[model samples]
Target chain A: MKGNEVLAEAAMRAGCRFFFGYPITPQTELAAYMAKKLPTIGGTFLQAESEIAAINMVYGAAAAGARVMTSSSSPGVSLKGEGVSYMAGADCPGVIVNVQRGGPGLGGIQPSQSDYFQATRALGHGDFYMPVFAPSTVQEMADLIYDAFDLADEYRTPTMILADGMIGQMMEPVLLPPERDLSTLPAKPWATSGSRMERKHNVINSLYLSPNKLEDTNYERFERYEQIKEKHQRQELMSCDDAQIVVVAFGAASRIARTAVRDARKKGIKAGLLRPITLWPFPTKAIDELCDGGASSFLSVELNMGQMVQDVRLAVNGRASVDFYGRTGGVLPTPEEVLQAIEKVAAGEPVVQSAEPGAVGSLLPHPKHRKSSYERGE
Target chain B: MADYNHELLCVLSGFGGQGLLFAGKIMANCGLIDGRQVSWMPSYGPEMRGGTANCSVSLSDDAIGTPFITKPTALIAMNQPSVEKFAASVQPGGAIVIDTTLAMNGAEGVELADGVEVAAFKATEIAEAEGLKGLANIICLGKLWSLTNFCEREVADAAITKCVPPKRRHLLEPNLRAFQLGIDA
Candidate 1:
């Protein structure tokens, strides 16, 4: 099955009854699949007038205690930013899927990881962070969607599945998850469903007018976020025990990096791959431990203009050098290009340097760093 | 049987409406039925209609990496432009199969180096003669199967049966026959 189709089926099996989404390229198939299947299952699949309307609908369904979801591409996601922040503030549990395309404004409809900063750092308008899952394969895409909903309900927060156009459109055999019994679903006590003169009316809102109460809510949410980081920092470490160079990547880019790692290994280079399955948790501890285990350097390979490299740098903390290679606007970096970058780092050459402030490829020089035999080519 | 030790990456390319993606899907499904790992990624874009359409299929015993097949082990070109575009990208000793109905006459039309193995077949001609007009892509698949034996013939048949939608079940017999014709040819 295609990744998008698998995601929709997995969402159904995960008990997603309310799907409010607007059609967007690369992710339209997911919504279309839901439109066809959700009806037969007695679920609601709505195509809203706009992205903002779709996200707000998600908020409503989530507050009503239904497993709800919305999907969009990059530009569409930006339109839902305000509503997403509202969902976060209200502590609503739902899933948002961003099948990212190249973007700043109506960018080309091609796969990109440029939304890394938007998804992990500041998804909406707040100091809050959402747990973002980046799946490397279609199977992982289905598995993560199946897992995201439960995590959302457990934490009472929105979870985002950060997939790119490549992963969304790619086809691979996936094992569909077994359906959950809707009758056995856990009760949402905070839902705004009719109280019917019950014990007390549950008010689901983020609008705490008092400053102290809002501060308290913020503190409690941060506490839960910290716990999520500690317990759910998922990563895949490949050949890093004795590797001198570790390449960091996620999603489709990670799959390419893995191939490069294999190619490097065939050429007698001790290379490895570190794939961050959960981007918000950032998998910092995993990279730190690998560095402590004698990995000499780190290289971040991404499909954007190098966004994830900053997190890798913060994790490494100048203990070893970190470099980056990226291609923006949906241009996929070939494995040979990645292999070449790996070779440069293995040869102890400074392949990239911080050309400007806050740039992604910012390479801080170390006193112990060796000189490069080759200069940066253009 | 196909070699299970190494991976086989193949690209099937042609113009839109030529069933390139469908042929690739069937090959990937065959790999799955045989219990080999497989991935199929098509060239998705605005140009997908009336433009050069292609899909990469990888079959491997172990986990495969990078769904994009830059250096394919085999190339199935269903049109002249497809052969011209992808022939140079085949790895040394890799096979290049072109539909002689649209591509260069014989193997001399394409400009691949000598180390590459080239196979040319009148896929469209065979399909037309067999009264299976739109089954040219299936015919090409049969040639690919006969050459690489990536999966057992039974697996291909089963995949064909499985890939077609239930509404299109009536075309199964003719499709299989077209596939077999290319294999025998």
Candidate 2:
């Protein structure tokens, strides 16, 4: 199954009956799948006129206590930010998928992790955070999206699947999750369903007029965030015991880093991989544990311009030297390239810390203006 | 039965409408049939608009990390641009299959690393001769299978059957025939 289609199927099996989305490349297949499958299963699939409209529709459906979702690529996700913030302020539970592409403003349509900061730090103008799940493989795409809906409803907050185009367009065999019985789902008591003249009508709104009341709501939301940070921080550690250099990565970049770490081990380098499956609750505990265990250095590999490296640095907190290696604008760093970076770090050489203008140009040179290493007989 | 213990990374490249992605999909399905770990990833987005199209397929007994293949153990190049773009990247001791009918030079001027094997076949001409006009991709697949023996013949046939949609069932027989022709050629 393709990753995008697998996410749609998993969302369906997780009892999601409402899908509101606008078409965007790399993620359009997911919406098309929902448009084709949702109606046959007695669900609602609406193709709104714009991304803003789509996200607002998701907020509305979620307010009515439906397992609803919306998906888009990078720029479209920026347009939906306002609605996401609205949903967060209103305490609406929903799922948002960002199959990220190259960006900063109408960037090219290629697989990129440039939206890392956007997804984890500033999804919208807010003093709030969304639980971001990053899936590297097709199986994880299914497994994580299925859990995203439940996590959203459990905490009454919008959850995001922060995937890249590589996962979205890739194909792999997946064991589809079993369908959930809608009757067994948790009831949303705060939903604004009719009062039925039996009790006070429920109200769903984010507009708290008084300053004290607004501050209270923010404090309450942060309390739930703190709980999520403590319990829901998920990570995968590979060969971390007695490791000198630890590579921190997630999503597609993590897959490459995994291979590089294995290769480094074969070459007698004590390298390990720490992959964070959840981006919001950034898995700081795992890093602290590795640091406590005497891991000396950390290398953060990504498909962007060093966004997640900031988080890794924060987690390390001067306990170890943290380095950043990446290629932005939808370019993927090969396992060999990452291994070379690992080798440099092992040899006590400083790898480049940022995606500088010259560095980015040299990574993938234009075929017309410059000869590749192969062409240059290197 | 070929050994399925090691990894087989393949890159199939051609024009947008040349069915290279479909060929990669069938190869991935064959890996699944054998219960091996597999992944297929296509080069998507604007570059696919009248530009070169390619896909990477990885099959191995162990877990696959990263579906993108920068250095492939096997390559099937169906056009001149694809041959020029990817010929130099095939790993040492790797095998490459090219459609000489389209890529006339057939990696002649390219500087391939040591121990690389090259097999040139007039797949497009052969397919057209056999009334399989759009099946050069499958023919190239057959030649690749013959050289590498990545999987059993029965597994390849089963994979093709699984991939050919029900509405396009009539193309199955012709596809198999074209594949056999390439194997014999």
Please list the C-alpha lDDT of all candidates, in the order they appear: 0.87, 0.91
For candidate 2, state the interface root-mean-square deviation in angstroms to 1 decimal. 0.8
- In candidate 2, how many Å is residue A124 off? 1.0
Off by over 4 Å in 2: A353-378, B1-5
Model 1 off-target regions past 4 Å?
A352-378, B1-5, B104-109
TM-score of chain A of each: 0.92, 0.94
| Model 1, span A115-156: residue lDDT tens | 999999887887688889999999998899988998899888
Worst 10 residues of 2 chain A by lDDT: A357-366
For all the candidates, what are their Cα RMSDs to the real structure?
5.0, 4.6
Listed for each candidate, the true contacts retained, as a fraction, are 0.79, 0.82
Chain B TM-scores, listed for every candidate in order, come to 0.92, 0.95
Q: For residues B18-70, what per-residue lDDT tens digits would candidate 2 score against the true structure?
A: 88999999999989999999999998866578788999999998888889888
